[model samples]
Target: MPYRHLFKALQWGLILFCLCFAMVGGTMAERLLELLQCQPHANPALRSCAWLPNALGLRLAPFLSAGGISDYPFVLLQNFWALIAVWMVALIATHRAARNAASTAALPDRGKTRYPGITGADAGRWASRAAFWVLLLGLAGFCMAFGTPILGNRVALEVLGALGCSPGTFDPFSSPCMSAPGFWTHRLAVYVIPLAGPLLAPVWLFMAFWDILLAWTLLTAAAYILQDHLSKRARRPAP
Candidate 1:
């Protein structure tokens, strides 16, 4: 089988996935950071940036609500779907391309050419494919991990109610103001959670990287099993 089309499809799939992730995920992350930075400030000028209270609130609502952290998983799911979609499309395109190339080939080209295992060209091709898949998979995993909690409840309160240093309630000088060490600790949590969430995601990626390896191993194992079975059958006495 001509692997060139398959290779091309994977290439395009990676590009499409990255573009979509950057456009959607990147935009959300930026706005989140902006909201976090500006919403906490006491200055009326910074707070009155038109996209205040309600606007920013709506953007952050998913992550700010009690279980807002779930939104990250939801977003990560979205990224996965995007990659899946691209991969499927690429598969179809690769099949069509292979068919077309086959149809145009010389009739005598029906015979298969055997290669001495893992030639330089073959190794290079495998390396390129591995690299691209790794890059895309890594980013998607990171999005699911880091992206989920970066703008979660703790972070939300910090950004939305940082001045109050209170939990549950946003009104700082209201009847139930938070002045105790508990309030301060909660405030510290709010600050630290958002800051650490993003950083931790990437760091955790190192651990999660095993997921990619496992997937590759399973796929390759399946291929090897099929190949071994076929090889054994070929060597069998007339069956």
Candidate 2:
């Protein structure tokens, strides 16, 4: 419990950081999509599209562009969510570990004696199983989120390619293209590419989610260490 206040402050700070980053990334992503679909000369509603891309370009120039310059915000948003998920798992693991340790320590005879019917070992084993399931489910959810966009992108691209439309040359959002075959496929790609492309990029994956996972591991380890120290202290004989 030493530096508990500091730890809490740091946790809140990280949450705030993630929230702000996600918000900014989401906004940028929306704007980037708008810019891509905008035809300012042809559409009166898209006049702001001219300045928005320029502004985003200026802001994002210094940062690493994953997949492409336009895909950076989506990558950032993906990593932000990944970080949040990892934090949730870490918190659950830490809480379960600490609670089990405390329960074991509180049992008679240094957790060796059974109270009534349930023993400390039983409690620890149950906690361990619960933690394992929680971790497994969290990992499954992460993988699903990570892969969904990629799968969608691939299917969309395949559809477009089969219809003889080149994604690079096709303008799916244009009025003329509205009647084109595979229009929906192109539409899907437009949405999926922002998410899928960056995730597929090894450099971006390393730059973003890898760091988040590493931080989660370190924080969880630190929490367990602290919990173990407290449990050991409680187990010592009173002077």
RMSD of 1: 15.0
Decoy 2 TM-score against native: 0.30
Residue-wise C-alpha lDDT for candidate 1, range 134-166, written one tens digit per residue: 555655654454345453333434444534334
Q: Provide the global lDDT of candidate 2 against the true structure.
A: 0.47
Residue 200 accuracy (lDDT) in model 1: 59
Which ranges of candidate 1 are over 4 A from the true structure?
1-105, 109-192, 206-239
Give lDDT tens digits, candidate 2, residues 136-155: 56544544443454553454
Q: How well does each candidate superpose onto the true structure, as a TM-score?
A: 0.25, 0.30
> Cα RMSDs of all predictions?
15.0, 15.7
Question: Per-residue lDDT for 39 in model 1?
Answer: 47
Clashing pairs in 2: none
